[model samples]
Target: MSTESPSITGPLHDLTVIDLTQMLAGPYCTMTLADLGADVIKVEPPAGDLTRHMGPHREGDSPEALGGYFQSVNRNKRSVVLDLKTAAGRTALLRLAATADVLVENFSVGVMDRLGLSYETLSAVNPALVYGCVRGFGDPRTGGSPYADWPAFDITAQAMGGLVAITGPGPGRPLKTGPGIGDIFPAALCAVGILAAVHEARRSGRGQFVEVAMYDAVLSLCERIVYQHSYTGAVPQPQGNTHPLLCPFGLFPTKDGLLALAAPSDRHWREFCALIGRPELGHDERYATNTGRVAHADAVRDVVTRWLSSRTTADALAVLGGRVPCGPVNDAAAIFADPHVRERGMLSEVEQPGSPAPVVIAGQPIKLSRTPSAVRHRAPLLDEHRDEILSASSAAGDPRHNTSQGQVQ
Candidate 1:
């Protein structure tokens, strides 16, 4: 490990998590838990998590099984190979479940039940266990569609959840978000639910089932569309970056780059006009009121663009920042280099478990005065701590105490 790799430490120092989910949704949720200092055991099928081979890879034939996508989300976890298809493997899982504080899975609707690890079954064995399930749609028992058995990925959920319908510029060409918002955001929401349920279990001495559907999560993300369509009886068409209802609240060009400016309030509009050296715009009959400005938004935008064209992005920001709300649309590199980002500590470096060098990663954004979260450890190797985990249980001699050593049969 590199000398600069951060030391592992956090608030959730000893919580144990049994992660049964694979791919993005489940892994991402457990990743969050692992970040907060849970001992996350990533149980993979014998073939391994599908993401182990996902690209953009470090080197085509390198020793590292991690893809860039996998590494980004799967840090601070231990890998355990479990063939749930086998009776012995199922028994091993049950043993692990008996001790886990939380269990997360994203299998197809009935897969867990067929594998004998359904929440109902596991809860019977471990009542205080938080069981989290992330499915493509709502559960079959909760009025999900007949196609509940069908497989879904990010794009499928985005399309079904009304996110793509109003995302692009033209009515005919809606766009999906670049990242897997359908999968990632729902995973985050599911994790939040799992944590909340875990907290309740800690207080009430009972664990509950926590479920999140990607379709439902994406729907929540695009909720404003429902109201807009309802009030006007007009379905929202794709309008690119601009909001249909708000004037001058989207991307605009500066001399060197793009920036987003918001003048949502009338006072801000007046302030924006003065800041852009166009105070007369605030007095012009066609542009004086916010309604007038909205009506002549094109003309107002043109005026603002003209003013911005003469100055560099920094110069334009300097003039408009305090007077009106504004921000330069920074790309990834710019964001990493910005002073505010440094000041806010939004980035950190950690060494991969077996790697010789450090990797820079986006850091925790949320801050708390007390009991703050942290990146406890770099992601774990496959079954790295299995020995440590099972040693205590093995020594205790369970009801099926036929195993010869600390290793689980």
Candidate 2:
């Protein structure tokens, strides 16, 4: 299969996104832009994206695999390598910024300032530039802590922002989210901010600074816990995969597999009881109402589990369909094989240079009717576009843009 670009062209087709981010969070944001038809030029330092050499390698490809982790989000973007540690490189980057519609970065706070590429400095050269930044914490100007200079990643954010407190099975078993959701999700949110800022810039001809912090984003994810703690002075405990206040809202094992069920309302509870052929459950004084059911969740789960033990996931799902909210617990393979997922085009194929078979990647979520975004290219080699970008940019005038260094490709 060709790793040729997908046919979809999105509204941001003409937009230029200069990606100065590294690792997962920043790269993930720029990848979304690339998927959305933006011309995202990934500006890597001489060493290239660190993730390229961070993981499981293919034979011969060795240290440059860029890791499967890197490929997932770095696809469809052009890369240029420059030694930003030098003055000439800084000059080149600024020139690129002058031509770019937006620039994204995820370095610790003040790195940009130290490099003389802060929003104030850059906007002087390019008044309409949309500068999006992802930080460990928030900017000090945004009511964040002065320790914004510190480095952080997903797990640290989850722990500091209160997600860890309200996660997991119960007390003392506090768990972090299985994925680097804290980083990835904030990157997504920051992408939105960048896009929105660019849209506004187009109209007003004024650029603005857009920022998202891993901690701040995770805090948004912890809204309920924050509210509960503030209003009721109640310390939220880990409830694992289940909701603390909703019974029958967690994982339940079926004969063949696990299924997730949610019957939060009194009406759903009645519907659930009827579906299970346990109408007595609806009449039982201890489980008749949502509040009662929550208070007696252990007994409630026991009653629900007994019925699930006898049924296959499909049978249970079919009976509960539309009436009561439910779904089977699908693993990754199951997710890829699911008919609905395939129908929705949630999986896409990407051709790697040396791999025998094309790698399948998750599809972009933002679907547009007029200008739809689609996968256009495989993830480029480190500084793969160094020659192309430098040549084109150099011919455009400044020699600063043409001097490529440390680009591996």
Candidate 3:
């Protein structure tokens, strides 16, 4: 790598993450750790991560060098490209894995074993190395899945994990969430698994393999569906903007747009009644408590919906400001102009590899007092750190440089 690469300053600065992942889930997980100051060494194939070519690029920018999608999930990382089909590449990777604190991959089951880079093999090379994997079902080590060998992606997980089943306008027409929560949620869980395993490794002087199945992770996210099914013994149909058990807990149309309100508890319901100029409703026997309101949901909806129709989003927020939990159902333009997003530094400008103009992207969400993390640098160029990573060549064998490249099977 060059001296221009970002410097380590976060809590994870001492750790090295050997990243063998692509697309969304695995890359996003490693990116989160990289944001926390881990030295993430992205090992790509001879071509590169597929995402490097998948994007809306600047008119003159090279597809091999920049992609909007790749740039979003790959900041603050160093890249190395290697041909794992070659003996030299496998040897180089094993050497790098020997020194790494963690090794993360999202290859299909048995891919690691076929390539001789499984946790069993790597742990023998370095017993303290944390091995993490994100798969459609799960790694065979944890429990062999019936679909262990099936190639899966975000939509497959969302469907099988029960997220798609409950999400949509109604039953028999389930819709995937607008965002790729199927992949993103699994990636987030895998990151959490990596950190938990890392903590245990630090204390026990050993490490183990951890796997996050996309199906399982998304299933966990849709917890209410499972619980409601178990308790009621009936399939829950989509209720649209209204929540099943909580009244005054969904999207309500305003004069101009939409806003969300969640005043299901008795106290909030009382305060909500007062805020909407209906204080008498707080003492009404039919809507006195959450359970009562839920039973009389039609009445509750009529009251709130009518009140919302008479006011605009801003007026509603002004009236309900501190007394109720509510917010505008913001569109992109509104979100961009939002004061809260600005105050929280939610948007960050990052300089990419080939473009003269910097691009704006979402900022790192995690905050640390002593070791803050951020979008410290641009997405890497393919094999940009090859010389620094591979030994027997110039710039290699430096103790400060702790990364290598290899194409995962």
Clashing pairs in 3: none
**Which ranking of candidates, highest TM-score first?**
3, 2, 1
Quote the positional error of residue 202 for candidate 2 in Å. Answer: 1.6
Assess candidate 1 and give its lDDT: 0.76
Best by lDDT: 3
Q: Candidate 3 local accuracy as lDDT?
A: 0.83
TM accuracy, model 3: 0.92
* Two-way lDDT contest, 2 vs 3, winner: 3
Q: Write the per-residue lDDT of candidate 3 for residues 1-409, one digit (tens) a residue.
A: 1122255488888888999999999999999999889989999999899998787777775444477799889888888886777877777777787777899999999887888777887787677889999999998789888998899899999999888888887778788888889899999999999999898888877888989999899989999989998999978776678888999899999999898999899999999998778999988999998999999999998999999998999999999987799988888788888887766767777775555667766777888877887777878889987777665322334222443222111
- Tell me how far the alpha carbon of residue 42 in candidate 3 is from the true structure, in angstroms, after superposition: 0.1
TM-score per candidate, in order?
Answer: 0.89, 0.91, 0.92
The top-ranked prediction according to TM-score is 3
Model 2 spans with C-alpha error above 4 angstroms: 1-6, 58-66, 283-288, 395-409
lDDT of 1 at 104: 91
